[model samples]
Target: ANHGLAGAEFLAGIPGTVGGALAMNAGCHGGETWGIVERVLMLDRNGALRERTAADFEIGYRHVGLRDAADECFAAAWFRLPAGETAASRRRIRDLLEKRIASQPLQWPNAGSVFRNPPDDHAARLIEAAGLKGLQIGGAHVSEKHANFIVNPERRATAADIEALIERVQTRVREAFGIELVREVRIVGDKA
Candidate 1:
């Protein structure tokens, strides 16, 4: 069972499926889905099945790399957890969820924060200081509340528009602060 404990309760709010969660190592707040993983059940293309330990894979912040098995796919996972106070865990989850609702643009169709924070400094602070908050390119605009987030105000923005805006923000931030902002959101498909 997928335990949505602590700050991981945000996983329940995410619209993606379990398969996507596995593929992306999806997490939120301070909780990572893979942190509690003990073992994973996988199936090969030829229908062969196997069980592998979490230690058998390379686990990172938002990525998991399997060893020499690109053709295999995760079928399920065994997660180990310590017995804890249910009330406390539920309270913590509630608090984290409240914090996320208050801070993030949950009402919008955003793919979440556009860039990851670099080192000790925050990407939002950098973007805001660079005067990028509330900046807009077509229907895509940098969120005024959180500079690191780009929101779709009109919901009709093309990929090119978002790409251009992201590039502009990166360029401006780099030119002003000499910090290169790396994108967190994966951009796919051809540019229009």
Candidate 2:
């Protein structure tokens, strides 16, 4: 944004690295990471580097995966951002950041939005409508400020606590509205 590149202003509001953004096709404020991608450098587990374009992968809202189902990670990317006024891009980034600060539980430990918004509806709204706000499991709770967020205010919530709370939220919302909430944040671990 400082260099007058347009279209990447949404990245300012995202919390993770470019690699994570690419992996998930992360987006906010109407622009997604994959939307500006020209080409990408990928490294497979066997250490072979390959260059691929958008056609080589499937991209969608908060999701990206190799077309061939290759086990690889994004090593780097070349973006194709259009030229724009530096001041305007900076202002856009600032506005997005401000909006995030106001609506998200930034002061507490969180993994951003827990669930992907269902078609034509928001996860936060559904969670709130289900009376799940401030719902707790151990030290983790659905944030009162933003129902989509599970906050660990004192940093005392274990992985099990957070996972349990997520399941509870899913159960209640499904029972009440019959819409199954799909998680945005990926959980990876062996169950004990």
**Which has the greatest TM-score?**
2
**Which stretches of model 2 miss by more than 4 angstroms?**
none
Q: Candidate 2 — which pairs collide?
A: none
Question: lDDT of each model, Cα atoms only?
Answer: 0.77, 0.92
Worst 10 residues of 2 by lDDT: 183-192
- Per-residue lDDT of 94-178 in model 2, one digit per residue for the tens? 8989999999999999989889999999999999999999999998999999999999998999999999999999999999999
**Which 10-residue span in candidate 1 carries the lowest summed lDDT?**
1-10
Score residue 169 of candidate 2 by CA lDDT: 95
Q: Model 1: per-residue lDDT, tens digit, 112-191?
A: 77886788898999999999998888888898877888989779877888999999999999999999998867686776
Q: List the residue pairs that clash in candidate 1.
A: none
Q: What TM-score number comes out for model 1?
A: 0.79
Cα TM-score of candidate 2:
0.96
